[model samples]
Target chain A: MSLQEVFRNCAEQRRSALIGYLPAGFPTVSESVGLFEAMVRGDGHTPGCDIVEVGLPYSDPVMDGSTIQSAAERALRNGFRVRQLFDVVSAVAASGAVPVVMSYWNPIHRYGPDAFARDLRAAGGAGLITPDLVPEEAGEWMEASEEHRLDRIFLVAPSSTEHRLALTASAGTGFLYAASVMGVTGARESVSDSARELVRRTRAHTELPIGVGLGVRTAEHAAEVASFADGVIVGSAFVTRAEREGQDGVCAFAGELGRGVRTASPEPAGG
Target chain B: MTARDLGGAADPDELGSPDSGSHDPDEGGHFGPYGGRFMPEALIAAQDELAAEYDKARRDPEFVAELDRLLRDYAGRPSPLTEAERFSAHAGGARVLLKREDLNHTGSHKINNVLGQALLVKRMGKRRVIAETGAGQHGVATATACALLDLDCVIYMGATDTRRQALNVARMRLLGAEVRPVSTGSATLKDAINEALRDWVTNVADTHYLLGTAAGAHPFPLLVRNLHRVIGTEARQQVLERTGGLPDAVLACVGGGSNAIGIFHGFIDDPGVRLIGAEAGGHGLDSGEHGAALTSGSPGTLHGARSYLLQDEDGQIAEAYSISAGLDYPGVGPEHAWLADSGRAEYRAVTDEEAMEAFRLLSRTEGIIPAVESAHALAAALRVGTELGPEAVLVVNVSGRGDKDMDTAAHYFGLVPEAGITGEDQQ
Candidate 1:
């Protein structure tokens, strides 16, 4: 399913879509597929995630906190290759969730953007989430993603100006990733007040679905973000749980967040 | 007299051109297809603000005048160019003129960029300055500038560097800068840069990341290079005044290529003068233990810019090795990559052994203890000098002094007794 369809589906249910992320080949390549499958079919009843973000492990994950960085390091150390990402994406798509690859820009640039886009489209994947690439430097990606009919997601932070927001919104295809705070990726105890404000401000710029990420830790945090965001994107929390308790832990947490998104009270109007 | 001078990715073939535009990176900061902003969205505003402010400041007479005054009276500008006659004897009797950046107030060319950026920080109304360092020279320079400017300073250094360059750590603390040892991702220079970027992302509103090298995102490669351009400008003028013409070739060591780029800009417009950069060949390029990004690496992005990077086939940044802590990096600045691609400059790798030999030779022959990073260029000069023969005039940028490297040097040459220092300490 396309990302727009997932958001539309979640809107019909009156709930925010739960998006789960796990670095490709974390722990091991073969095991990662099973973990992603677990994320898709969480708790065996309600779907765990409408979308699965497959991380392309990079050596320098400057935006990642210790949990994700360590996981990526482990994946890279285990000899995870770029080709393995295709297998993970294919598995995630077969399992249930729309699979999208989250990668730093260098790998895609090194792999050739057009070829990467073509191969990804062939693998039943939705698109790419480039954490490090801004729209200003994404001329090739813009052209390639357009040619291949893949979603191109770009992030906007609280620090983004109105000009920047419009530029990002226009360049983005599938959704706009709203970083909740001025920080790297990590699970925090509470989602900041700025996240709601940022989401509201972003609504002025683009009509695309907006996903709130970075520091959406507990179900409470997810629910709070769900009130204002179209999608509650959880990454480090799943990785942190997976580190200690493996796939089952991640599935259980995903189920909790999945339910939380449905039960959230709407944010007060103008808040 | 003023430093005002000076001057990835994509389609496996559609990015970075040898001749892109007039301003090198042009407006959006692209050199050929290398060198553009590759930072997180959170930091784009900061980068843009920096680029905008720098654009205005370069043209603002008040800013230029203040910077000039600081360089002249504070950092000790117009560092003399000395003739290295004794040292040149080992290089087939070539006439070698050394740009004495080592004689600057802080003992290196780093002060040039640091003071300029510290001023920019002040102009931007940011009170806190953050930086990352490998050998500690840049850290010391940043700390020094912050102290002088009365700005709060925090430095991130690799945990290993903190141990190896402990004295510089003490020096930073003494200068009132907080030093944080980063223990993640090989615990080296690149990791420190990552940590600094994290800090910048978290606290960019009141902080300015005083990037130390001419690598990194758009404004930095341009900003740092412009700040250090005085090196080449002064050397060019000095060489002309002293020898009546341009040198046959100019050589400087390349880590992130700041000093080299700084010096190269003065001579870049002179088609007659050749620019050469020496990279660190730790064990050797063949052993996969070297920082020779330009020599053996491929085009890729790391630390916010596209350049020649030592990376795996999958685009993972590979660890760069060098005996010199300052020269240990997996990536070269994008401008140097452009220069290499355009054939405007050539780069060669100098092994740890060759650099150490040059380090000792300079000290014994000319009473000048060169930094191991600078020694790489000196080693290259020795080879190039021989190739150019007796009448060739060469200008070598002695980028820094070796005071911070005394411990490493002592261990390498066994200057200290066996019991005083162990091989494990060197490691």
Candidate 2:
């Protein structure tokens, strides 16, 4: 299913979509796939995660917080390869949720963007979320994503200028990722006050669905962000839970966050 | 990303501006296709702000005047070029001219960039400055600059470096800078840079990442190179005045290629001159334990720019090794990558044994204990001198003094004696 369909489904349900993230080879390849399946399984009533962000573990994850960085290190130390991503994606696709890959630019650049895009699409993945690649440096990525018909999600920060906002927003083919705070990816006690303002500013540029990520953890945090954003992304929190508790804990948290998005009455479409 | 076809080294006339020198990168901060900002969106504003400020400051005569004054008065500008005749006896009768960056305040060429960047931090109204250092020379210099400028300073250094260069750590502390020893990936220069970037991302509101070398994200490589251009400018004129013409070749050690790039810029326009950069070969290139990125690596993104990086086939950064802590890094500056690719410069790997021999030779011959990092250049000079024979004139940048490295040097050469030996006993 397309990212648009995922958001449209969530919109029809009068709620925001839940997007989950996990580095592909955390602990081991087989175990990581099982964890992803658990996240997508939901509470059996509502979808656990409308989209799964399959993180490609990289060596220097400068943008990641301790929780995610540790997980990525563990994944890499366990001999995670680029080909392992397709295996995980193919497995997650069978679970009835849209799977998107979140990676630093180099691995894909090294793997060849066209080959990566083609393989990702073949494995039933929806798109890509590049945290470090800005639109200005994405000339090749832009063409490759276009050729493969993959949703190219780009990010905007609270620090982005209006000109940059318009440029980055227009360059994104999938959705606009709004970093909730001016920091790296981690679970925070509360989402930043700047998230709503950033999402509001982004609305002025494009009608693409906006997902709020970075510094989002608990169900309350999810509900708080879902009130304004079209999608709510949770990453390090789930990774943290998986490391501490097992698959059951992840499922329980996903269920809680899945319901969390529904608890808050979203702003009116025009509002 | 696929290598963008940025076609060969651009000619000034082809760039459509005759007055525009070949020293500057493009407006996008790309040195051909090798240098561009591959950073997070959150830091885009900071990068843009820095780029804009540097653009304006470089053009403003007042800013240049202030910077020049500080270099002259505080850091000791126009560091003398000395004739190393005694050391030349070992170098195939070549006349070796040593650019004495070691004589500068704080004992290295690092002072030039640190003082300039510290001033920039103050201009930007930032009160705190954070920097990453490999060998602690950059850390000590940064700490000294912050003390002089009255700004709060923090330095991130590898945990291993902290142990090896303990004297520099004490110096930094004395200069009133907090040294945080990073224990992450390989716990070396690469990890130190990673930790520094994290600190910058979190506290960009009131802190400037005073990057130590001519590597990293956009505006950094460009600005650092510009700040260190004085070394080249001074050496070029000093060479002509001393020897009636430019030197046959110029050489400096390359960690992130700061000193080499700095001195290379002076003779970049001199088509007849040769530029050589010597990277650290810790064990040997064949042993896979070396920091010779340009000599043995491929194009990949690391730190913040696309450059030649020591990375695995899967694009994972490989840990770099070197006996000299300062010359250990996984990547080279993008501009050096451009120069090597364009055949404007050549990079050779100098093994630890060769570098140490040069380190000892310079000390015995000229009473100058050069930093182990600079000895890499001296080692390359020995080779190049032999290749060029007696009539050749060579200029080598002794980028730093060796006081901080006494402990390592003592250990390397077994120079350490028993604890209670008197001077008379030795005689």
Candidate 3:
């Protein structure tokens, strides 16, 4: 199903979906696909994950944390290229779960806009998440993505002004990524209550479903955040979980997190 | 502005006049095809932009004027042509002239290239500069240029190097450049280069990738070498005033090969003078540890340019090992590879022990503690002196000062004798 349909159902049900981010080509070139598959679909041999983000590792990813950076280097050494990233997306799309490409515009720009769009479409990519691409300059990519039927996800943060929030909401499709914290991506222990309010405010800005992410952990944090946003994109913890429980731990974490989102109370009446 | 300029995919010849390199137009940047812009379809535009702009900038009067102004006022140019009487005395009573590039403001010859590139950055309307550094020297030089120009700057370094050379990290931060520790493969200078290339590829429109040496992709080797040619150019004229004639030989160490090429260019056709490139042999050539690419490597493409690379049996570039971070790359500058083949410049390697011995010898004898990279050249001079029986005069390019190497040297010599920051130690 389209992420929009999934989002609509998510909104009606008052729950969130899981979006797990992993650096593309991590561990090794050959292992990345299998690892990704395990995270998205349980093969009895692998763990079933929800939405996935495959990061196109750049030479200099200034905003990323250590885990993602190491993952990128391993991927690069394993012969991962801009075009190769699309191939991974194609392989995942064939299996069922949507694949999201998380990258900075430099790689996209370095890869060229037209070729980048074409490859993303050819791979049946569900969407894109470029944290560095501001909404003011997002229209071109948005239009191109729409032409290819790819969801161009935009990030909404507490620091985003009202004008920017509205503009970004209009430009984005499929989902609006609501950051649960104020800093760069990393494994954090907790998020502030203001994150929940930001998600609520973001809901008022667009009919689009919102995914509250960044620093959201714990069943309580997930349940509380699920009360407002359509989804909770937990990246670092799953990466941490994968590191901790290996493949087994990742499966359990994703499976349990998916269940937690579904059973959590959607109403802010917890107040 | 795009990758199309880097490879110039279709008519790549259009990227340069072929003459932009020291190659003939018919050859198309071919040092017998071992040198040309052999890159992916993604890098063409960036290379093309740099090529076109660099051509104009090289000849522009204002660019030249600005470089001159900085070299004079900011960097303290016309660095003396000091006569190394004591160091040369035993060799046959013939004098040795030292081009004091070490005396430049940033403590090395790096400032010359950095100043020129910084001026070009301003002229091109770029507001930020990014570079990769192995040793903090290039980062410091690049940061100095950015600060002087008031441009935002960022430096990428390998995570491993950050611990190895924490002082450079602190120095870069003081210069207002953000020192980003890259956690990529082995986290050394090459990874830093990869990261810096990524940054420039992403932010090509308004950012200049200030390359540290005469290596890497097209235009960089050529451009950096041309800027540093000033070192040899000034020294040549100064030496003429003091001696009334050209010296018998000119020698310098070759890593990315800039310092050698810069000094050599001034005398490429000088039949009266011999040119020598001293490469790092690390431990020794037989033991497979060295930075002497032209001496020990085969011709191959690397960093967007063709050059001699230390490669494995499968033809893949091998990891080069050098005690000197500045000389640890697997490839040599393209021109150096050409010069080696043409037999115009003699190439030799100085073992790590030999270089360190020379490093101490120069310190104790001449009171100049040279960088390991520069010590290679001095070691070569000692070899030349022994051969010529004290009658042959030689001029050595003292490319950098030794202050930065004290910590590394002190530690290596057990001068500090402190067991710290490795293995079982934690601070």
Candidate 4:
């Protein structure tokens, strides 16, 4: 499904869905895939996640928090690689849930973006999110993403100015990842007020959806953010829960977070 | 961290090393397999031009004369080679020699590399210099050079490091270099490296990347080590003159491998002089708990080139963990890799426990508190001295003073003396 379609569906439901990220092969490659399947089949792996963001691991993951860092290490020790990441999308596809592969530029550039886009699309990936790949330098993959009918999502932090936001929004297809803070990705005690302002700023320039991330971890954090954003991206936080508990624990944690946000949804008016 | 900790020996335009070819990187800046034109294609010629200019400056008699004068008058060069009789006495009667780099203006061998690089950057017409630092020692040294040169400087540091080494951070700002906190990735030295590289790439037009150790893409390792060799060269001469013969062994700590190579290169041809490197064995070598790149790491490419790297089964780089920031990395200089493989140097792993013991040992016995990084070498010296017996003489590179590491040491040793914001407490 297209990201726009996902956005439309969320708009109809009046609730932002969960886009959960687990570094591909967080505990192990086989387990990573099994986790993806479980999350989708409602077998209780990351329960209630509307979208599965299969995080492709990189040697230097600059944006990760402690939880994600540990997960990446576990996955890396299991020998995760760019070429083999497709198996994850394939497994997630088999379970029939939204697949969004997140990664850094080096791995994508190294894997040949065109080939990667093709492979991901073939494996039923819905979109892509790369924190390191800026639009100016993304010609190599931006075009390939379009060709493969995959959404090329981009991120902008609260520190980004209006001009910068407009450019990011203009270039972005799936959604503009509105970062809640100025620092690296992680769960923080509170979300910045600029987050809502950023959502408004992006809405001024583009019709593309805005998804807020970084520090939006708990169900309350997600619900609070969903009130202003079209969607919420939970990385380090969910990854944290995944780390503290096993896959079952993450499913239970994500379920609470997802249900919490969904409960905040306004009821539809009856005729 | 801040730059004041790097107070140094020479002026920015005129560093301790005379514009001698001893310091210039070749046409594109290199020393053996150690140097190369590893920058982007656009910056390649710019670096070459800088290298050529350095060559011309080296040949200039006036430049040589100025460097010589500064070496004598400013840096207090020919830093004493102290004979550690008391410590040596503990060495089972083996004579222990020390290259007193701790006496250098900045209290370490780091000044040698920074001064040379800062001088070259000025000659190359760069107005600003940037560096990435871990423990803030190299940053202080670089800041000192920039302060002396009046060059605009910026240092990238992981945010976590700033908190742990706050005094050093303040020290840098005092020296007039801006400290940029890197909040990215683990908030450690590696992230600082990434941020610094980004800064270098973006500001290439007016900036020079002043690398701290014998690592990086090319020319950096070679350029840095060559500048630092003066430490070994002087020590070697002093040791020879004092003892009337070459020491049985020369030992130094290995981080990016510059200091070890600095002193090692001077004695590379001296077959009789045994060269030893002590790496950070954080916990224990048995549990894969060390930075013994030469001993445990395999030949692999990392940072910028092929070298001895601590990697996993699939060859992915493993995060280097150590009590000392300087030694927290997975790779070493290519030259050291060659040295290790060729069996030219004997490398050993010294754990934090051992290094701490040596730190305390040196402080109590010699009244000389040495940096934890340097303590590895001291511990090795202690071990080797005991093994070699009474007639043997071992020279250990006291790379730097332990003042900067005072807090860490105190905390680690459970010597939690209530240190307020006192004048004496700060490094």
Model 1 misplaced stretches (Cα beyond 4 Å): A267-271, B3-24, B419-427
Which should have the higher lDDT, number 2 or number 4? Answer: 2
Residue-by-residue lDDT tens digits, candidate 2, B1-427: 0000011122223222214664578877788889898998888899989988776666555666777788888888879999999999899999999999999999999998998788788789999999999999999999999999899999999999899888889999999999999987788888899888888888888999999999988988988887887788889999999999999999999999888888998899998899999999999999999999999999988888999989887888899999999989999999999999999999999999999999999998999999999999999999999999999999999999999888777767666574333333222
What order do candidates take by lDDT, descending? Answer: 1, 2, 4, 3
For lDDT, the strongest prediction is 1
| Candidate order by decreasing TM-score | 2, 1, 3, 4
TM-score of each: 0.95, 0.96, 0.63, 0.62
* CAPRI class assigned to model 3: incorrect
Q: Which stretches of candidate 2 lie over 4 Å from their true place?
A: A269-271, B1-19, B418-427
Docking class of 2: medium
All DockQ scores: 0.83, 0.73, 0.04, 0.05
Q: Per-residue error at A34 for model 1, in Å?
A: 2.1
Per-residue lDDT value at B216 in model 4 = 65
Which residue window of length 10 is worst by lDDT in model 2 chain A? A262-271
Candidate models: Cα lDDT each: 0.91, 0.89, 0.73, 0.73
Local lDDT at A106 for model 2: 84
Model 4 chain A lDDT-worst window of ten: A262-271
lDDT per residue for candidate 3 within A148-216, as digits (tens), equals: 788888777665656667877888888888766554567677767867888767767787777877776
Worst 10 residues of 3 chain B by lDDT: B1-10
- Model 4: residues >4 Å from true position, as ranges? A1-56, A61-83, A86-271, B1-56, B418-427
lDDT of 1 by residue, B1-427 (tens): 6423622111122122335422347667788888998999999999999988886777676777788888889988889999999999999899999999999988999999999899889999999999999999999999999999999999999999999999999999999999999998889999999999999999999999999999999889988987888899899999999999999999999999999999998898799999999999999999999999999999999989989999888888899999999999999999999999999999999999999999999998899999999999999999999999889999999999999999898888767895355544332
